[model samples]
Target: MSAFAERKEMIMTKKTAYEFAYITFAMFIISCSIYFFLIPSGIVVGSISGLSMVLNQVINLPISLITFILNIGLLVIGFIFIGKEFGAKTVYTSILLPVFLAIFEKICPLSESLTHNSVYDLVSYTLIIAFGQAMLFNVNASSGGLDIVGKIISKYTHLEIGKALTVCGMITAATSIFVYDISTMIVSLIGTYANGQAVDYFVGGFNKRKRICILSEHYEEIMKYIMEDMNRGVTIYSAVGGFDKTPRIEVVTIMTTSEYKKLLNYLHQSDYKAFVTVSTVNEVIGTWNINKNSRKSKQKEVSVQ
Candidate 1:
């Protein structure tokens, strides 16, 4: 079997209670954000929120009710376009979201405007809710509205996620404009933009992209961190320093960003003269030696010997 297939198999088989907790927490966050912020503002942040706002206006239905009804069709579409894996994960998220929204709405009843200045108030709430919404999605949970719809578009239309989300947001926003207040439309647009940005920002820390760029006299020590401590594969690049003509050893490894930060700090502090540069990598397609057999098998063990 190909190495990629082995990694994929490992990911599929691995299960833990923490994953479930994150998923459920993500669902709850999205639901509460929708109920307290978007619904109260009559604004939509994306495809799902937009649809709920529009449907609620047209039929005078509760936003959560509309979300629940719409998700049924979107879920089917995801199954067709995105496959069973995404669809299966979305199933629990999709159901739990609307349930949380409905329950929160009934219990809290935060719909009454705290201030007459709904525009500013709307934006404030939208930004606040985006925080929670972003956190949930950062952990790979769905928002259960046109959210699944956006994913479906990405799967079937062969579009990138941002483009798919933008397209979905536009359609839903335009549809909503006819029925919602003008201020709501404006807030909806702001919410959509904010939602997208929030996802990109929070997902970085939450998803964990580990990268290392070492600038040090102690090339061996950096390599030790990469091999012994991190136990990840590394690529070494030889570079000449701009001012000194001295050759520098640059080691690059992919791990979680937190891990990367920790390693970077360690290298910098251990060698005060060390200059390190780091980047937030978008993706890292590799494995750490954490499996039962590999737990004690250091990369240094494999490479140094």
Candidate 2:
């Protein structure tokens, strides 16, 4: 085979390997968080696990048993309500999550609650759950039950999924108030909100930073403010000013929205002559190539849409 063809094959192999590795790692992290940190403490922020906890209370069954049973129903519903691919992933997470939890429950137990527990710990648990969940979503996977529901919602609704999850979470939390501790429900609500927000914030954090590519003669002042004052990264690209054949130095500086707004006010006050083009960047993949392609409706939304 040609060298070029061989190189392309190698690249594809690496890419596929990386994708699987990431998904596998994400699943491991999620399982650990659920079994280790959340489950033993009855920290039901929602999902199969939360429902499992509630049912476990009445039935006097282990959460693992409840989760395992519910996951079967969810997986079937997901196959029909969502799709096959989702069902396939649910098969693993659903089964494995319970297995891991059961093993952890039998082996490792936390009798005492988290010391100094408050709204902050509530928020902290919710945030941690959100982070694991967001990772699963990023890789187009699920952790059974409501995650399947969330995916189904995203697949069908064509709306922002984080918002959909937030809605579902609130309902679950509200319902739990009748079943579990009111304080736990309130804390779950807080965690649910934080989880939804944290997922979006975490996913959008990198892309939130934008580089305003400005075409101006007053590059010095903007450069100084962006670099010296803001301590942001700036790059100067060579270009010819449109409507004038004059060669000019275009200033490109990267900063967040608030920072950009501050810089904008500064530029307006310092040099209104500057012509800046602000583009909403998606993500910076490498040293360059801001990946605007990363953000999209989740699988559940696509099904409905």
Candidate 3:
């Protein structure tokens, strides 16, 4: 094989390994929340697992069985709609979640709330599940439940993942009304809201980037530093100074937090008196750091990776 192909395969293999490692850890976390906290406490956080809990009350099915069956159905839908990478990762995590729950039940079953306080249970489940979901969402994969629905909504309607999840979660929360008491149902709804908020917070922080605009006499030097040294793309725009009407070149680029920090440090050390503006961008669309023609099919949707 060619050297380039060998290197490319190596990189992909490493990335795949990392992705599955992350997926496994994320599933373990979600399963912990569902089996130990959500089940015993009767607090539903509005995912498929949450719905399974309600269904388990009516049918004689275990939560793991309900979740496994529902996830298998959703896996087919997810594989058809979403890209293969996402679908594949979701498959692993979705199956792993139920397996984890089953094992947890066998090894150490909790018949009562770990904290004995519904409020504490609600907080624990919300925080743990949100973090787990955010981790999967960050990798453009989900734990396959209502997450499949949320991802579909996000893909078609262009809604943020958090907002899409909130919509699905509210529906799941409403279902609990029939099975749970008024107080438990109300808590379920609140937990759903908190879950969405926490997911948004984590996803936003994970995907945040800096949109930077720089104007300076040494603009070419700055541009060179960005493109050649940092291996990032920059756009050059011709602009006129508003006050003086003097023509100038502006360098615009988007970078991660660490990249922005490096640029700032470079500027300070070099004593470059550059006019700079920075904005936090929560989402970026289209091709980034890749050839436009290569990603024409994905240009319309947001690139989570």
Better TM-score candidate (2, 3) = 3
- Per-residue CA lDDT of model 2 for 141-160, tens digit only, reads 77777777777887789655
* TM-score of candidate 1 relative to the true fold: 0.73
Flag regions of model 3 displaced more than 4 Å.
Answer: 53-64, 102-114, 289-305
Candidate 1 per-residue C-alpha lDDT over 1-305 given as tens digits, one digit per residue, 9 for 90 to 100: 85545654665455435556777876776666556555555445557656776677779989867876787788787777767766776787767766787787678777475554556555666555556545545544465566676666665786644456666776677676677677767666766665555545555455556466777778787787776676666788999988889977777777776677677677767887777676676654445534523444333244646
lDDT-wise, the better of 1 and 3 is 3
Among all candidates shown, the one with the greatest lDDT: 3
- Per-prediction TM-score to the true structure, in the order listed: 0.73, 0.61, 0.87
List the candidate 2 regions with Cα displacement exceeding 4 Å.
Answer: 1-13, 53-66, 80-84, 99-109, 114-120, 206-278, 282-305
Q: How accurate is candidate 3 locally (lDDT)?
A: 0.84
Instruction: Name the lDDT value of residue 81 in candidate 2.
Output: 83
Whole-model Cα lDDT of every candidate shown, in order? 0.64, 0.69, 0.84
Candidate 2 vs candidate 3: the lDDT winner is 3
Better of 1 and 3 by TM-score: 3
Error of 1 at 136 (Å): 4.1
